[model samples]
Target: MSGIYIHIPFCKQACHYCNFHFSTSLRLKDEMINAICKEITLRKNYLANNILNSIYFGGGTPSLMNADDLSKIFETINKYFQWSPESEITLEANPDDVDNKKLKIFKTYGINRLSIGIQSFFDADLKWMNRAHNSKEALDSIKVAQGEGFSNISIDLIYGSPTTSDDMWKKNIELALESDVPHISSYCLTVEEKTALFHQIQHKKTTAPDLERANIQFDALIKSLTSAGFDHYEISNFAKKHHIAIHNTNYWKGQSYLGIGPSAHSYNGQSRSWNVANNKKYIDSINKEILPIETEFLTPSIRYNEYIMTGLRTMWGVNSDEISVLGDMYRVHFLSNIVKEIDSGLVHICDDQYVLTERGKYFADRIAMNLFFVN
Candidate 1:
């Protein structure tokens, strides 16, 4: 099953920790949309299969777009590709952008899933993150979407912020559970370089996220959500039965996908490509009927490492049979290195799959790196 990801590079305000490519001004919104449609037409045959199982509208904030903008894009998509009624269609939204009228418009456009950004349900945490929406809006957005009949919904929450104490973090999870969202994606606050949070940390204006505190909160998140009948499907994602995110699950499972718009990335098993991140350059190049993309063909070692990295972070785990297909040497290397992890109680073997233990999830990246087949 293949998927399509559309990046909308416009936002109303900048979050302190965001490093995504976007513009606060909507000056080029129309041109950007036109370029996106044209690019979709140009790359119509990029994916081998014309049938899409999922279509995700990710970004700077897809909810910022109106009905007309979405209509034009959907029209182009329908003109080229095919999807059944069961196809998962998701849109990333900010709480402030969701209202009764906007939700109705989104529903009219065939958006079945909503991934709302509700980082925290506290005014102080929202202020710290420089989020545009307040606590009330964050809570109300989900209710409003539910009221509008969006049952397959997900909400994002951030833990490990300095302003969020252990109690506050627990409260955030409790509030999210009370909202009855089928899925929740919670991430630890990281200070990426070039983001305002990084600058603040560098200048000693704010404290960096405490690793110990973050781990504690992660454990709490797992315990609370699991007790409430949510599956820890992915390290940072939890969902009730049959509610896992198909689009993101496809990505982790290394399925093919096509990406539309500037700064989007695509993968087709053998290679990966990403479009030029600059909005103006992307628009100009698309206007000239050129794809502003850079491609990289993956080597066996790189593919092996990538699989190990992504596979270990999920509940499904990594299959030894799949590793053996990469090459005999890769299988040997993985088996030899993974013994220590299993012996140390960080990983376990179950029916020819290597799955991370509860202790290992905290060090998933490091463990994956240890098992990497570096060239």
Candidate 2:
């Protein structure tokens, strides 16, 4: 099975911390929609003959698109590929854009899952993030989605914001639990380069996110969710039993997926490519029947590094057997290097997997790097 990720690159407002490729204007919305449809038709064979088990509409805000535009995109997919009836079709929406009218249209066109961007249920946090939605809408959207009979829901939350206190962070989790969404994707607020938040820090207009404070919040998040019967399947993600995000899980498992639209990425078994980040350039290229993408053939070392990086972040951990595929030298290097982590109680071998221990979760990236093959 494979997946498709469609990026809708327009947003009503620019969040202070977001660095994802997106435009704040809708002047080219219609043209962009057509370009996406064309891109889908052009890349139909990217997944070969695999059944599409997941279709995700992500981006600036997929909910921003009208039902007609979304339905047309669905039609294009149905024409080109084999879509599984049980496939998990997720649409990432902001709270402000959700409504009963839109919900019915989503159900009619087959959106079984919703990943709402409810970064916070507080007005101050929402304002700080420059989100288009307000507190009332944030609370209403989930109820509205449930009222419309959309069961599988995932909402995002951000932690460690300059304006968010620990008490507020706890309340945010409480709000999420109250909503009873089956899955959640939360993260420590990051100030990425070229974003408004980054510039604010650079100019000393705002202090940088406190790492120590963020760690405390992360620990609290794990404890809270774990006690509430949610699986900490991956860093920054938690879900109820059997309700994990399949699209993201597939990516971590090294499955092939074709990403469409500006700044989208695609990967097969051995190579990867990304479309141009420029909206107009992407549309122009598609109009000319060209894929404005940059490609790379993965080296064994790069692939090995990626496997270690991703595997260490999940509940599944890194499989030692899979490491042997890279070469006997890599296997030896892993065994030799992992002893220190094991001795330090950061990692342990279980069922042929070199999995991180509880304490190791916080330093997953650092541990993965230490185990990396330099040759």
Lowest lDDT 10-residue stretch of candidate 2: 44-53
Cα lDDT tens digits, model 2, 3-58, are: 99999999999999999999999999999999999999888888865588899999
lDDT by residue (tens digit), candidate 1, 248-357: 99999999999999999999999999999999999999999999999999999999999999999999999988999899999999999999999999999899889999
Poorest 10 consecutive residues by lDDT, candidate 1: 80-89
Residue pairs in clash, model 1: none
Instruction: Give lDDT: candidate 2, residue 257.
Output: 95
lDDT value for model 1: 0.95
User: Residue 299's C-alpha lDDT in candidate 2?
Assistant: 85
Error of 2 at 13 (Å): 0.6
The reply for model 2, stretches above 4 Å from the true place, is none
